[model samples]
Target: MRFTSGTSFDGVREQLFTLGEIPGVLWTPEGAVGTRPLIVMGHGGGRHKKDPDILSRAAHFVTGGGFAVVAVDVPGHGDRPKDVELDRIATENQARVAAGAELAPLIAGFQALVAGRTVPEWRAALDAVQRNGDVGAGPVGYWGVSLGCGLGVPFVAAEPRVRAAVLGLGGALASAADAARITVPVEFLVQWDDERVPREESLALYDAFGSAEKTLHANPGPHGELPAFERDSALRFFSRHLN
Candidate 1:
């Protein structure tokens, strides 16, 4: 896999040392620009930044809406080269890995490890954005989905520069205390019948948010069925907070 940015956007560059030692795509709109809003986007479990489904919608956020977007490929997924895939660990007896039993700890560790890499990388990206001068110079925000949401929580929690966040189809951290640490306003977008992740977990997260400015949107549908709605809601929510 290779890290890539949209060639159509001007002032675009690829940052190699991003979260999880992955690559991030940075895109700035054409011609006139100065100190615009920045959004650090994250992909779902096994997708890349240029996922046809995601980038198609994301193009609106960058080119049409004029937001600088940086979407990173998570370690062991997307364009990042990986030695092993967790889901590939299947034996005769362990055909299906136990739900939370096998994945919870692994996901927790991945998020922690990824969070450790975010600050330095984000600072580097911020520095570059500032240097561009014509590009992003204002506050930053985050938008994430599925496993991305899991990582985004810790990312925003540690980096207060993120003014707001939009999380789609993902749960909060293991502890509400951890969730309470985030200071920015956040929007939790979830499907009521998400079978992959319990609906209760998302609510527990929404209920746990310590930020007084946060809100929760419970949309109708299942996990995969709601990505369109999630995208619209996230765009609107981020616009409200970022602007």
Candidate 2:
């Protein structure tokens, strides 16, 4: 857990750090300390920990909800060395989808390969972050969608420290069993007209969760067009469960 740089702006402090090979970023209210809620985020496919959306949401969780938020680039993303095989397979999958091949099987196999490698990395990141006093022993939440959701299903289910989650923009083909193991509060999102994830599959993923307290929010949009307000809803969801 080596922080390479630190910066502060708008009452939120940002730190860029590396854990072994993983590149990650942490955000918290300025001068924060003691036990505070932590939100661990996973970026979507091709996105890094500090993309615009992720940075904005992390800032909100820090300044608006007064929570600590962190995100790490997972396998082949951000500053980590890319996997040639993963890239090849991803390109193949995209071409197959365009050729009218069924998306579920292709995506399922790809996500399985990625998730197997990522779950352990995420567990390590969570362990390191929580040990830092600013986030110590506090309730932890997870926010991830798309590739993040595929990988998160297993990580969150296996990690009891994650008390709540905001997951969506992915399907059940590869993660239904893990989803059933997640008993924490979850707020699952769905795009009514998602082109990448089939609607039935997304609904099925939400149904797979074992959490007694879970809510499903479906909006009309494509996979990349989630309404701006859903971001607010995610913050509120974390607030309700973590604080």
Candidate 3:
């Protein structure tokens, strides 16, 4: 991993890094030293590691919880070279949207394909993060939703370092088996009126998890309208399990 730039603000330190072409951002309390609990954040579709929402949440984890946070751009999603196949899929999805066609099927297939590539990238990034003196090998947590959740389910299943996760806004399509492999404690969110993901699919995804300790918080909203309090709750959840 190579750190290309960094800044300090609001008692938090932020660094831009690259791990073999994967662009990423790391956040920690200013002047932090030694190993600290880590939070690996996954952003939604069309968003990068340094996306605004990711940054806001990272700040909370760093300044409020004193946890180190890392977020990496998924393959074809940020600074990485675009994938021809993903571009083709995106074109098709755009056409489908113009035709008022259902987007779930196309998104399910596309997310499944991308997951095969990103899970390995996340593993490699974590390896590098652990080697960093400040982040070190400590309790790790994951927070992802929508596209993030779709990809993260498989990653958390394949990588054992993540002890807790905040996952939701995703369905079971292309993810049930991977979700079944995840045994870490999870705080799952669901929007009752999510137009993108059918309610049954989201509930089924929650049911698919193999974790003995998992909680579901279903609220009334669209896919992107999770209540703000959920974010606060999620940070507290991470603090409980990771700190």
Candidate 4:
């Protein structure tokens, strides 16, 4: 990993970094000593590692909760060069949605194409960050919504290091088999009136999780209208499991 830039605010130190071709950011609590619990965050589709929502959540984890945070730009999002096929699919999917066409099959195909690449990239980011030796060793957790959750299900399922997760705002884009493989504690958020993801599919995705300790938080809102209280609840969940 190569360090690019850094800043500090309200006792949190945010650093920009690049691991090979992947561009990412790491946030550590100021004056924090030794290895602390680490939270690997994932951003929504069309958003990058530095999206305002992602930054806010990372700040909550590091500045308010004293956990280290890291987030990478997913392939074809953020700083990564666009994949022609993936871009084409995304464009077509948007057109279909605008035309009031069904989106599940198209979304499923896109997820299948991208999930394979994303899962390994997340693993690699974890490996590179651990090698840097500052984020602490207490435990690892994940927090991601929307596209983040779509890719995160399989990543967390495959990764043994993550002990807990915050996932939601995504439906059954990937296979239920992948969600069924995640055995760690999970807190899933569902927007009751989400326009993009159907309520039934979101509930079904939550039900597919293999974790014995899982909670579903459904609020009445649109896809981007997740309540602030839900984020507070998620912080508490991670604290209980990771701290």
Candidate 5:
């Protein structure tokens, strides 16, 4: 990983970096002593690593929970070169959804294609960040919703370093079998009235997790309307596991 530039604010050190082709940001608490926990923050589909919500979550984890946070632009999103075929597929899927056509198949296909690229990119980011000795080696965790959850399931399952995870707001786009391999503590969130993900699929995804310590947090709201309190809850969850 290469550190390109950096700035600090509110006791948090924010740095822009590049891990090979993937561009990303790293956030660490300024006054944190010794080695601190690491949290990999994932953004929703169509969002970048520096998205406002993602940045806020990173800041919360670093400043509030004393963890180092990192986020990378998923393949074809953010600063990465856009894939023309994927863009066409996404547009087609949206049109199909508007016409009340079956969306699950299209969504799953898109996720599969993207996940193939993203899962490894996430690993690369983790490897690159860990190479920075200053970041320290501590318990690692993941925080992601929607597309983040879909890609993260496979990534976290394959990466044994991640001790806990917060994954949800996504459905059965990827293989539940992949989720079954994740045995770490997981806190899964679900939006009761999500317009995109079917409620049954969300619950089924949660049930498919192999983690013995998994908890489900469901609330009434649309896909993007997750309660802000859940952020605090995730922070607490990470604290309990990583600290």
Candidate 6:
């Protein structure tokens, strides 16, 4: 792992050498380069913007399997120029409070970020990673938990380059039409006891999958946590399709 530069956050270092203009933490082994399969890790909703768990997970893929990993701060959360605080409140609170006006914009801002995924900035980031030669030549993969899962939906749908994805603790059946657009393999992990996100919603999404390779795994855990076995399953799923 290499330390590139500091980002908007105090201790968060930006790994721009590989991912170019994309704002994220890039991790790869020493003397690695090329258009490797990079795992784009997204964070869950909440105050875990600078969470060590998410960062450590990215490092594991980089060091354990030589996969390039980039974890970006989704709009409305983290160090991005959005309403980091308002996003933490409950949805009901957001609907009731005047301060929640910022929350809607933050959500819209996140959507905009995903919509622009194919634009120059994101492409430049991909180009930078390819230039570094750390990412091996393979189909790219994406992984996210909670809110990151929401973002990854459009990401994989619009970006055909993302051949595989793993989403945990965040999913909703927006509609059959939107779900039909996802053409890649996706492994969705959900806990039966999750209170934050209804299990029915995830089931609806699982039913809406158009990909022949999609899988749904249900385990036991809270909305904010995942069991050890689920984490292993997630990594294995990514490795299988990403490599």
TM-score of each: 0.79, 0.96, 0.96, 0.95, 0.95, 0.75
Off by over 4 Å in 4: 95-100
Q: Which scores better on TM-score, 3 or 5?
A: 3
Residues 64-140, candidate 1: write the lDDT tens digits.
55677776666566766763534344231144344325444345555555655554665565566555565546878
Q: Candidate 1 at 206: error in angstroms? A: 0.9
The RMSD of every model to the true structure, in order and in angstroms, is 4.3, 1.2, 1.3, 1.4, 1.5, 5.7
Q: Score candidate 2 by TM-score against the native.
A: 0.96
lDDT of 3 at 225: 82
User: Residue 170, candidate 1: how far off, in angstroms?
Assistant: 1.7
Query: Could you give the candidate ranking by lDDT, starting with the highest?
Result: 3, 2, 4, 5, 1, 6
List of clashing residue pairs for candidate 5:
none
Give lDDT tens digits, candidate 3, residues 54-170.
888889889889999999998788787887889988998899989998777778888999999999999899999889888999999999999999999999999999999999999
Q: Give the TM-score of candidate 3.
A: 0.96
Q: Model 2: per-residue lDDT, tens digit, 179-219?
A: 99999999998999999899989999999999999999999
Candidate 2 positional error at 175, Å: 0.7
Candidates in order have lDDT scores of: 0.66, 0.91, 0.91, 0.88, 0.88, 0.62
Going through the candidates in the order shown, the clash numbers are 1, 0, 0, 2, 0, 10
lDDT of 6 by residue, 1-243 (tens): 334574432222236432333345676655554656787776776534346767767666666666777665554545555554444434545565455453433443443444354233343454555555546456788777666666667666766677888876654543334457887888888888887667776687677767898888887867767776766776788788877
Model 6 clashing-pair count: 10
Off by over 4 Å in 3: 96-101
Q: What is candidate 1's TM-score against the reference?
A: 0.79
**Pick by TM-score: 1 or 3, better one:** 3
Candidate 4: give the clashing pairs: 35-136, 36-136
